[model samples]
Each structure stands twice: as C-alpha cells, then as structure tokens.
Target: MRSPFRRPASRSARSTGVVRVDTRTKRLTKRLQPGEIAVIDHTDLDRVAAESLVERRPAAVLNAAPSVSGRYPNLGPGILIEAGIPLIDDLGPDIMRLHDGQRVEIHDGAVSHMGKTQVIAEGTLQSAESVDAAMEEAKAGLAVQLEAFAANTMEYMRGEWDLLLNGVGMPALRTQMSGKHVLVVVRGYSYKEDLKALRPYIREYRPIIIGVDGGADAVLEEGLKLHMVVGDMDSVSDKALTSGAEIIVHGYRDGRAPGLSRVEDLGVEHSVFSATGTSEDIAMLMADEAGAEIIVALGTHATLLEFLDKGRSGMSSTFLTRLKVGGRLIDAKGVSQLYRTRISGWWLVGLALAGLLALATAIMSTPGGQAFLGLSGVLWDDIINFFRALVGLSPQSPTV
Candidate 1:
C-alpha cells in the first residue's frame, strides 16, 4: 500500500547521488557535501544536530532509525522538512550495508544502487503533518518522563553523593582557578547570543574557560582560549582536541573512560575525572572545588523540555551541582544584561575631542581669539613662503 506522505513517482524522485553514510550524525554532517544524500542512524534528532545538517544543505536525509520516536518533540526532522529537504525514515539497520560514497538512487520510497533494478531498502517519507502528530503524542508522554526523571535523580544522588562532596577522582590541573572567575560554556540553546553578550565581561575579567564536549568548538568559534575541556569527547572536533587546552576526560566510576583513547591517540597530555554527572555538571564542580570566586554558565540547559530533548534520564547531578556552587554560578544571559562596559578608551578619546571642540567654540567668540587667529594665519603664510623659496618655487599663491 502507498503511504499518504509519499509523492507520486516522478523523475526527480528517481534522482541519483553519491551517499555519505555514518552512524554518528555529527560526523556524517562533517563529511556531507551539497547535492549528496546523508545516511545516518540518529534517533530523535535534536535541534543543534538539525541546524548542523541544515547548514550543510544536503539533497536528502536517509535515517536508519525513526527521526521522531515520540520520546520527545525533537526538532531535527521538522527542521529538515521545513527547509524543503526530503527526509526518509526507518529504513532499518540494513541501510547501513550501503557503502559510503557509493552512488545510489532514491525513488518511490525505495533506495537502490545506481544502474541496478534491485531495491536495497525502503523507508517512509516524513512530512510536516506526521512530525506534528508525533510531537503531540510525545507531549502526552512528558508526565511519564518527568516521573522517571525524578526517580532516576534520587537513585543517582544516592550513588554519587560522596563524589560530589569530596571531589573524588578529580585530577589536579596546571590551570589554576583559585580566587578567580570561571566561565563554563555548553553548546546548548542560546549559546551564541549568550557568548556574544558576555564579551565585555570576558575581556575585563579574563576568566578561566571550561568547554563541555561540543562546547569546546563553540569557544573556539568565538575566538576564545579554552583553559580546560571536560566531556566524553565523542562530539568534539579533532581541531578542538588538539587546540592546546587542558583536557579532563569524563570517566565512569568504574574507572573506564571511553573518551580517554581518543586523547591518548592524539598524544596530548590530559587528566581523568571519574564522576556520575553530566560533563557540564562536572565542569562546574571542578571550578568550584578549585576555588573559583564566581562561575558564569553559557548555554547550559535549564528547562524541562531541553533536558528531555537531550535524552537525559535525570538532572540530579545538575540540580545538586547548582546547589553546591550556590550563588557563584551565574547565567550568561543575566551577566550580559546586568553588566555594562565601563568607560572605554574610545569613549575617553571621544570626550577629549568634544571638550576641545567646545573650548575652541568659546575661544572663537572673543575679540582676542580673532586677533590671535589673524596673527597665526600671517605666521602660517610666512612659513609656507619660506618652504616655497627653499624649494625654488614662487612665494605667491599658485593658481588652481
């Protein structure tokens, strides 16, 4: 039976293109080029991932997993569809069998190799109405998620209370945070605007910068130096990993750190902090334990929907970390809004120019000032004549 969302078979539907395949959406986006098809295994694709994919301008997206799983109203699929990019979902794990950079044709809801009559896999086309219905259904499931989140928070707190209090597994670092301000940046919602707003504060304070996972790239994008980077390191770029920042790989309490291998492969010096919390939470705790006077957070998730969208089971560590940091942690939005740049060098220069102009205006209104000006003009003409004579030119004014 034909799906309601599927368009009638057309010449464009049979369009053939080279396919770039990756289980990781972020990695796939990096390799995806314009006019090429993107094959990914991402489920419940988030907004940031969607934005990245949209920026690449791919011809179409082929997902091996459901783009909208009704877990949460993830905006990824909606974004692609709204941007006029065709999204084919649930092609099954068999789609991964397709070789990367291989030419493939997609038509009539089926994917096939170029110049072949055999269909490799089939998927349903996703549209605006389907995505909207999934989102509505997902909203109804939020209560269940909230309950589960609360339960998980309690369980996590019970297991990791000691680590939170004593700062266990936090390796010593060369970058000192003692009695200084620390800026913790996350690549979450409104991060760009928040970072832009904190420009003045960053310039004046020169706080220690801690980037969490993909947030490292965000810091680099803003042309800021990273003092420390904390995360599992899966989403970060190779450029950011080798950017000379102090790396603290987030490890499991069992002493197994998946991200450590990548750091070791790069031959970079790093430390490990085995804790049971989000990378952002660990970063904040690290700063507080290191004696930071104040900590400013950029792009940290605070809303319920944000947490759900990220597919976090619970925010126990986030809640507890905030409690531990207390008033020291300030939101970037608040800092940008409240903090104003003091009189800068340019402002002083402007003031000096204005004062000089005012004085000259007052001076010009006096008879003594007019007489001085007339005398000064006579002296200026004499100097000009002297220079002209030296150069062997006529002293009289030259005709234009």
Candidate 2:
C-alpha cells in the first residue's frame, strides 16, 4: 500500500527559507524576494494579487486563511498551483505566531522552525484537481454574491444619484482635458498586454494620462508621463508619488480620506476629491466633465467575475458612471485589437529615400545634370585628397 504521507509533486520535498509575512498581499509582495517563503492572510486571492506574487517567484506560499474559501471561483490559488509554486492553505492562526524573517523548513506539507525538530504548522497541499473541485463548489456561492451586488447597486444609486449625474464634489485640477483624448490607466487584469498593444495610439494622439492608484506605477514603468493620479493612495510607490503628477486623493463621502497622511508626509502638493465610487470611476467622470474628446481605459474591470474577484458588492457606481460618460469611453483591449495607425517611421523614411533616388535619376538623364555630376566628382576627389593629407598620407594618382 502507498504511504498515506505521500507529498504532491508540486511541492518541494524539502525546502528552507526565511519567512516574510503580511496581512495584505500587495504590501507583502513588494518586500518578498525570490526563494523566500511568503505568509499571507488573503482569502480567495484575486488574479492581480496572484500575478504580483508570481512575479516575485517565492519558494512557497503559506496562508492563514483558505486560499479558496468557496465564496466564488477565485483564480489566484489555481494560478499559483499551475506556476509550480507550492500552496499550503488553512494552516490556522498558529502560523501567524511565527515571527517575520524567521528561518523555516517545509517538508511533506509540514512547517518547522529552522534548527528544531518541532513541526509548528501543518496544512494540506493544494493541487490542480483539488482546486478545480473547490471552484466547482464555489460557483454555487456566486448566486449569493450576485444578489448582494444587486442590492448594493440599488443602495448606491439611491444615495449618489446626483454625484453620478452632475459630477458634484469633483475637485479642481491643473491638467487640461478639453478637446483632447484622455487615457485612464488602471493596474487591473491584462493591463500590461493591453498597454503594449496601444503604443501607436499613445504616440500619435498624445492623450492626457491619468493613473488610478497603483496604476500610476504602471504608467511610470511604460516611460510615460502622468498628467494626473487619483486613488486612495495605497499600493502606489513613493517614487510615483514624487514624480510631479497632480495627486487627487479619493476621499469618502463623509470627507474622511485615510491616504492623505502618506502624501502629506512626502511634502507633495495634492487635492482631495470626496466621492462615492471606485477611483477608476472618479477618473472617468473627471475626464468626461473636463470635455475629453475620447476616453481610453486600460485594465479596468468590466466583467462580473472581475468585480466579484475585487470583492465589490455591486458595480452600481461603475454602471452609473458608464451611463454618465455614454459613448465617450473605450476599452483598451478592444481599441488595441481594432485600431491601426496609418503611418510608421520606417515607412516614411523609406518613402523619402525612394523619392530622393527617383529625383536623382531624373536629374541624371539631362545634360546639365551630367555636367553637375562631373563637377561633383571633382569636388569629391578634392575632399578625399584633403582628408588623406590631414591624416599624413600621400594621395595616389588615379589608375589609367
């Protein structure tokens, strides 16, 4: 009979590393290094968060909460499992007892302190089959989420109808958007790919760039200048905050903005916009009210699964915001796949060179042109002789 303690192939039979722990996945990922163990408290981790951790390439992921809680079919755990990163879930509150940066060894789904034989925590290893099973079960729970989302939407619409309709409480901004295209970037699903494909549009139109929260960092990574940034100010890098972009902190409807302190600590000038929607929604509204000819969105959530992954009760604000903007807004992915720029530098350069060669050939067919060519040959010889003399080399006579 096979041993009951057999380990999954995805897990390292024996691995040891220093632990980096955080209740927030974004903060933890920033400090996490390759080959180190990551300890997070995220339940039903979303794709964006999972992608961030995958980029770091950690040795293993230890979660205090269930990676897939069956609330919805979250894609995070499956992504990690497929990437060949070991995931041990539901290790319980005892796992949090371990101090940060402490050396630990993992073997056969057991975690033990380095230089000690005691197993501090044990968890079941997640596999493809197991994750798929959990997801199947989780689909049933999506109905509950959908109902809740609808209720939230109704409540939000009832409370914020005026703000959604008339763009009330929008703060004044220095960036001008009148009669020009606006590019509103969010660091959401497939943002990198979508951005990569929109290079031509960005180059040609030169749209005003508005980054939402950590999306500011994404803008900077693409080597584009940020005209404005709107968000709660969490998950954005200090470098991005200091990059001279106009900062608009997203505050609650009650006028409480928690992220203002970080901006103040940096000694940067910023404005506060008290609103009742996602930062992306606020950004779209701002661009629309500023009279942007067109608004291009990159990495903004559009699907039900995406909204669910974000843990939003409903997309009521987003829905109403879209209605407010009407036909002005366009998704980056759709635009990238459809829109094509007419001119390229190489094409223009080749055309210019072809035109010049044709003109030279036409000129050479005339008598005056022949005389000019002879004169030009004589001048070229003179230039060669001058260069030879400057280099201390004797000029040789032409061969007969």
Q: How does model 2 fare in lDDT? A: 0.85
Error of 1 at 284 (Å): 1.0
CA lDDT, every prediction? 0.83, 0.85
- Tens digits of per-residue lDDT for model 1, 1-400: 2223333221236678999999988778877999999998988888777777888998888899998888767767777877778888899998898878899989857899999989888988877677767777777777878888788888888988877788776789888999999999987776777887788899889999999988888889999988888999988887888999999999977778989999999998999888887899989988988999999989887677777777666465687788888779888888998766467678999999999999998987899998877788788888888999999999966322
- Report RMSD (Å) for each prediction in the order shown: 5.6, 6.0
Top candidate, metric TM-score: 2
The per-residue C-alpha lDDT of model 2 at residue 282 equals: 90
lDDT of 2 at 395: 83
Instruction: Estimate the TM-score of every prediction.
Output: 0.84, 0.85
**Candidate 2: which stretches are off by over 4 Å?**
1-9, 339-343, 351-400
Residue 152, model 1: Cα distance from true site in angstroms: 1.0
- List the pairs of residues colliding in candidate 1: none
Name the Cα RMSD for model 2: 6.0
Model 2 lDDT, residue 203, Cα:
85
